[model samples]
Target: MPILPPQQRTDPHPDRTGVRQAEAALVEHYPRLVRLAYVVLPPSLGRHRRVLAAHAVVQRALPAAGSRVRVPRVPAQSRRSGAPQGAEPAPEGAGAEQGPSGAAYGWMRLRVLRAALAHERRPRWWPGRLPAPAALRPAVPVVWGLRLFPRAGGVDELALDRALSTVDGAVRAAFALQLLEGLDASGARELLAGAAVADPGDAVRRAARLGRPDRAGARAMLWSGEFDPCTVQTRPSDLLRRRHRVRAVAAAAALCVVAGGLAFAVDAGTRPADDGRGPAGVAAPALDPARLLRTSPDRWADTSRVDFTAWPARGGRTDDNALLGRALRAWAEPPESVRVSTTPGTAAVPPAEPPQLLFADEVDGAAVVLFHDHADRVVRYAEPLSGSGGAALDFARTDDADVTTGAAVVVSRTADAARFLLAPWIAESTTRDLLAPDTPGRPLEVDPDGVTAAVPRPGAGGACDAWPVIQLRSSERIVEKHAFLLTDLGEPAPTHLTYMPKPGRGTPARQPREATGPDALLAWARTACSLRALAGSGVRSVNNWAFAEQKLPEGGASADWVCTRADTWRGPGRVLVQFLAPAASPAAPAAVVADREDTALCSKFGQHVLAATHWRAGSGRWYVLGAGSRAVTGIRATGAVRGAAGGPTLAVRAPRDADVELTGSLSEGGTLTAVH
Candidate 1:
């Protein structure tokens, strides 16, 4: 492909593209556009914030309903050379010729650049009512309790990033267009002008002075996870400050309410604190054990719903008022002595109405009470049988649960074991080691209350010797008869595990079979231990999909690329892409190429995934190997040992730690960059 002259004539009023067309373009080229915005945004905002702000800009770039967006068309010369007349200009950086996604990609890129550049400006009162700067305003998709920053690179990326930060946003934008968008010097200037830059020529000149890196070095610095905002690592966000702020606001609110009422004192001679209410107080649910909502033991048999709503209240301690009252009071307002904890994304507030009593039992010599709130939260209150002051309250989010996932809850967890309270539909419980697929499942002793005896927990003491999963059998007619798998992830509720057949296996997306059989057990063994990363992240279910397999170069056996996605009860989810080598140890960690949140890649909805890793051949030579899902029609590598193939696999001989960029061409005429 020849490089044509830069497109001139920054069309002030470009041709309009339909909303649907722009949306298609946005979805197809999402990562590229986001990278564009991330590079253009000012570094002062910080990497994590810049990443979130970049995503926000791209997501909000879609044209409004019933409105068409102005998108620039390819220059006349390019159209005459090859691209069709009236077609939208292809993104110079995206490596695609004119296509349906080209026009929309251009429009979205323009919008992202404008928003990112404008974000650097500050609102001024004297500037004829200038709009508030985007930097001063908050960006959407905020994450609490986690600091998300992009993956860091070596000294080269750090130096370049620091250098770029020193320049103005316009110059940074011009530089990024050339490096990331694959734009020529003149093309960068022209695009910057189209984005409404005041001095495009000056910006381009300043950018040029930085000295462009070689093709391999530029791709290594730009295309690597270094500047990709979508992929990030999470750290705890100021734990002490967050706690202090929460306590301060709560204390202030309480003080204001009490002070106001006392100061006014006009309410019918100041009514008593209790009025006519019981000792539990008006702020909490009725304290009496009889007031607790309980369903019949057989309610699950006839109900149309198979969720937690159908779980019957069980255990011999249901009539114990003293224990029940303590549980109820602790839930409403836990004392400082009572340790309270909530999974990520779970609200820490009390229930608005009376909660459904799922279990009030004595398990492992402790009085445990489980309540299901209408807000999709499951709360567990536990107190020692010795009447000691030690009590614990735990909250977990469990929204949108069905029989397969909501069938069991961890009632008690000891040092080396955990006990589960199975649902009414569960007939038998057993445990199996995923690593040893040939071994039979061991039976678990379940008491009459549906609470199982202590089963050995896997991943104890941070060692992945064995990965244990509970195999549940359902006896009820309403519930599915197939057995399912559940694993404890250090939470009150166990995360459900499902398996997706490899692509082209004639398996439907929605019907992910239970993680059973030798094949699934083997596949899961490679990734089950990885669940430790999601222990307290409020994950609801994890689905494992063998997305791709490629024959290794140099007479090595084939390798598999498995994607394990943990979908949280909260909307956001996390994905892990692993490269599993043949005959590797079950306890050996998979080579993770991509691990990030809020992405649809390798998911049931988005079946496409691209990843690369350096592997040594049997002959001891180094090679850069890449693989993609079945939908990928071809794979290509550039910079430092070029390679191209007609299928989903690519292998090129290179240095041991070469800086290579991998991109995949999809059957639908779209392209995808390697997972960051």
Candidate 2:
């Protein structure tokens, strides 16, 4: 190996010319940058700290060839007045066009201000304190030297400074950017995003309040050293930490005491081990059935009219051994003073009849009955069929009954037969529509003016259950329309029925629609997708694509898809779909992408139905796809919906492919048919 003579190593130190150029530029821009930093930072930090922080920020923002850098020209009108005109426009390709020394004066100013803002991460609850004018005199000589206010009819400089100090730190930063730096709303918002501000305009507005009619003048007054600095010697950070620690300790101590008490109570109340012989043959303590049912307030006294409906049990007969039977037996014979109807075969009443009592058998081996009176009182009774004749009962006056006409009635029930009654007189009426019909053998009825109609429903064991459409009418007109659905119709029929009101159908527009089947879901998805698109397109768009991707299914064709939209940024925005792929044939890349695009589009535009209207699952892997986008046009799926042997393929139909075969599976027979 021939060893070449050692080449002399070049010195890594910067050339003398570069050092002088940098020094010259720093000398030119240092004052302006310091002023910018001083105005923005003094309100939050100590005078000494603010000046030091400003120097650091300016040094970092300074160009290497500082002396050669050209100061961006501010329009004459903007500099002379505060009419939003003086700031220099950012140069195109700032870094490239400006070169190492090409950064615009406005750019440097903003950088320094932002750096100062970030220097202190003030806690939300931190009470800001400004430094005394005397302390700031050494660092902000220009501001201190200026005569802020005239002697006659001018704003009080001291009052203005105190007001500025009282404003939030973030708000003060926004004000400084807008009034002092002349940045517009969009620019301020962009800069404030890192400072945890949701609305820069709001922040500006809050800060502007302190300045009033002449914001610029008021700001000038504060900068002119008119106010006395706070005399408190406490540092904001230290005080905040101490306060937080004290609160935390107090909370912990209280929680420990509560936990200890709860533990002692639980230990003392532990029941003796139950043997097979049932409660040691002890007589059970009696409970007031009325109290058990009083889950909500009562308003039944205002009720003037009541209606009733009854349906046969889905399995054909009521449970003879239900706990409800025990309740019924306990209260079957009312007190002598109370009125009782003992007619055996009269349980069936005409639709036009105003029967005070309604009876039905639930699929869950329980019998349920509801009773209402003119006084707006209601009693709900339910019993399990497995036990011999005892029922759980609840009764209360309707707290939300109509006080005037007493014709309006509201009944809210849970899956467990817990009932809340409301009278129309006291309750607000909002119209809603039923999305589906009632279950087979589970007839639902609605009566207006003593006229009723039996709601027809599909038979039991169907793929889906039936829901009822109810129209609540008053003398004026239909007060509210709603569709009610029971999740569990088995014994005691779910006390809770979901009330879904139709959109744009005599209801408040801001109210959210229920997330039900494909159609409602598709609508919701469209809203979410639109919001995502808007946010993504906005200046502060956040790219949450990774989060969305994580929610997608790994390996299957989906049975259903959901697109959820959140109004706030913190909420989730994504399209989730599940597909089944047979264990034999894995889903192709195109198929997976198609499903994701479908969901994403659904989320964006609220339209889920694509060329492929329906999908089915086989014995394959299932995959969930979560696609996130802030833009409405974030993900576009183009292709004909086609069904293959393994699964469905939704091809992206772009311009290049003019003629494409579109196929779909018949939900009935799983037969493949050409759609387009």
lDDT of each: 0.74, 0.34
The digit string of per-residue lDDT tens for model 1 on 1-676 reads 9999998865343443345556776887888888888888866555666788788878766656544334444343332112222333323332323222244466567667877787767442212111244334445667888868788676457546755665788998887777677667776776687678999999999877553324346555878888988888876643544565576579668867876777587676665453323333433334445556676788787765577877988888888888888887787778889999999877767654567789998788788999887667889999888866689999987765677778999899887899999998888789988777778999988888899988778774557778788999887586556789999888888989988767764453334678887768878877877888888787888988887888898785888888888877654568998888876575466777788786545543356788888988778999898988877889899987788998888888999978999999987677989986
| Model 2 regions more than 4 Å off | 1-186, 189-414, 421-464, 467-676
Candidate 2: 10-residue stretch with minimal lDDT: 538-547
> What TM-score number comes out for model 1?
0.61
For every candidate structure, what is the RMSD over all alpha carbons to the true structure, in angstroms?
15.7, 24.6
The TM-score measured for candidate 2 stands at 0.23
Alpha-carbon deviation at 467 in model 2, angstroms: 4.4
Query: Candidate 2 lDDT, tens digit per residue, 1-676?
Result: 9999999975353333433433454576575456556556644343434454555556665444423433443343332211112232232222222122233444554445555665455442232222222222233323321112212122255334334544555676776666655556565565566344667668766665446545557556534532212111221222322444476569668867876777677877665342212122321211112211110112232222122111111112223334333433334433333223221111211111111433333423555545442223344455555766555544433312222212322232343232212232222222122222111223223332121232232223332222332222233232343222222121111111111122232333222233333444222222222221222211111111111112112333332222222211111223322222222322111122232321112221222222322222233432112222111112223244222322223323223323344433332222322211
Q: Distance from true position, residue 601, model 2, in Å?
A: 9.0
Give Cα distance to truth, residue 427, candidate 2, Å.
7.2
CA lDDT of 219 in candidate 1? 51
